[model samples]
Target: MQLDRLVARTMSRFAKGGLASLRPRQAPAEATAPLAATGPDRPRGSGSWANEWVGTKAAVERAKSLARPGRKRKSGKAAADSIPEGTIRTKPLMSARGVKLHNWISDRLEAEAPTCTLHACVSLGAFLSADTAHEGHDPLAGLVADLLIVDETGQPIAALIRENVADPSRHLLMLDALLDADLPIIDLPAKPTLSMLWGEIAETLPGA
Candidate 1:
């Protein structure tokens, strides 16, 4: 009976030792201390730092590009150059009396006279300097012509007046002002067809 009891006790101790050997051993607290100490104050991981640096560099390059000079202006010779050699830009002529005055004088001239060029909105004062400078006699003082027809050599030909049916008085005033400035006026018909307007322009030309 005593021998059997000793064998049973030894077997139980061997079984418990085998179970403990099978279980995984926990790492020491000192071994995990370095991982726990890593926080915001510490340097970031390699991948995180590289990504942040790349983002910052891209932003700086973009800022530098914007600050650089030699930027093209939208309204001057640069804008004109961007258009094709023969294409004409057109816009609506604003009027107060609900009459839609189309101001494609430049466009039409460009299309018809490929050799002859036309300039839009040239100041009357540029040609009528003497009249404009005369005191209390502002002939072109608050008046603007639609276009200046010029030959390819840039010779001033005539001043174009696009008529608005709703404002006959204004048209007459502009016509008188242009005449006083000693500039030939090409008065277009109110709601004129392209063919009709072109015919009038052809007649107004010196040799046409």
Candidate 2:
């Protein structure tokens, strides 16, 4: 009976601090375990962490998103090469030759097309164009140029080229592209007539 009582007291004392001691001892076992197992026997690189489950899911989704073509911005010669063999970025919106020169003219013209917008303006041109097939978040994302042209004598030319187009959205795109894309001097006309401008602007890529 005495031995039983003594054993009970001893067991109680060990139980009181056993959990604390077990924690430190178990750490070494966890260190040797696979990274995926977050338990005491698992290692740090075992890919086991508090957020490991959600991390794996997010990585998978990110990979899928990146796999889609044209979903991301391409750069350098590779980016320019992405243009199709037959489809040229500077193709004429009206005739087969006169290439649409500015991003604004092309984007606005597209917006006014059938699948695009169908509205027209008195002073400028139509609110949309005929070749437009899709829409975008900013309907007028590309419509005008933002620039001030000059001649040999530094006289500001009144030509309506991209640098001085009237549309606000187009202006912003031109500015952004100029700063970001290192654009070269492009050929444009001064104060292009409304008819000629629309004929040129309908099929341009926005901010291109």
Candidate 3:
């Protein structure tokens, strides 16, 4: 497949210089914090890192810089007609259901066997995102991952995304563009139960 030069550039950059370390082998700063315990009734913020589907404000900005599209659509519709491309307006774009779901995922991972292929297993709430950064021959840019997983070197291992609550067209566009770049994307329902999420993830679980 003729990948967009920009996408190639991103892959190359990630492979070469670690532009922005998304998820390395070591635990995230938050993961170092102690968890009170994993249970059915754990409070939201007790002993757990904040559930940031995106990230910190500074982190969000950094991610945006990397994912920003190279050029605007030339159609005469102006900015109004363009995709918002904004990942966040509020600090953390999470839902009540999402909070529980994310927490459960975090807890469950910690309870699982070691050497999990999904780095999220080691570092809960980890995320990965990619799109054309440079002005290469790619057609789309500013792609974002609600939840993505990567290896020690920031290479995309897998993409586990719940259905996007924003522009579906743009989300689909991003998925298509990512597929061209040879990244895999998995879709779950907007409100997947913990069991449902785990079931979906089981497919990607390669080794025991």
Top-scoring candidate (lDDT): 1
Model 1 agreement with the true structure over 114-148: per-residue lDDT tens digits: 55666655666665554445677765655666767
TM-score computed on alpha carbons, candidate 1: 0.41
Candidate 2 deviates by what RMSD? 26.3
For every model shown, the clashing-pair count is: 0, 22, 1
Order the candidates by lDDT, highest first — what do you get? 1, 3, 2
For this target, which candidate reaches the highest TM-score against the unseen true structure?
Answer: 3
Off by over 4 Å in 1: 1-112, 164-170
lDDT per prediction?
Answer: 0.56, 0.38, 0.50
Q: Tens digits of per-residue lDDT for model 3 on 50-81?
A: 32212333454554454445644566443331
TM-score of each: 0.41, 0.18, 0.43
For model 2, state the Cα shift of residue 190 in Å. Answer: 2.9
Q: Which candidate, 1 or 2, would have the higher lDDT against the true structure?
A: 1
Ten-residue stretch with the least lDDT total in model 1:
28-37
lDDT of 2 by residue, 66-102 (tens): 5446675554333323444445466323332223334
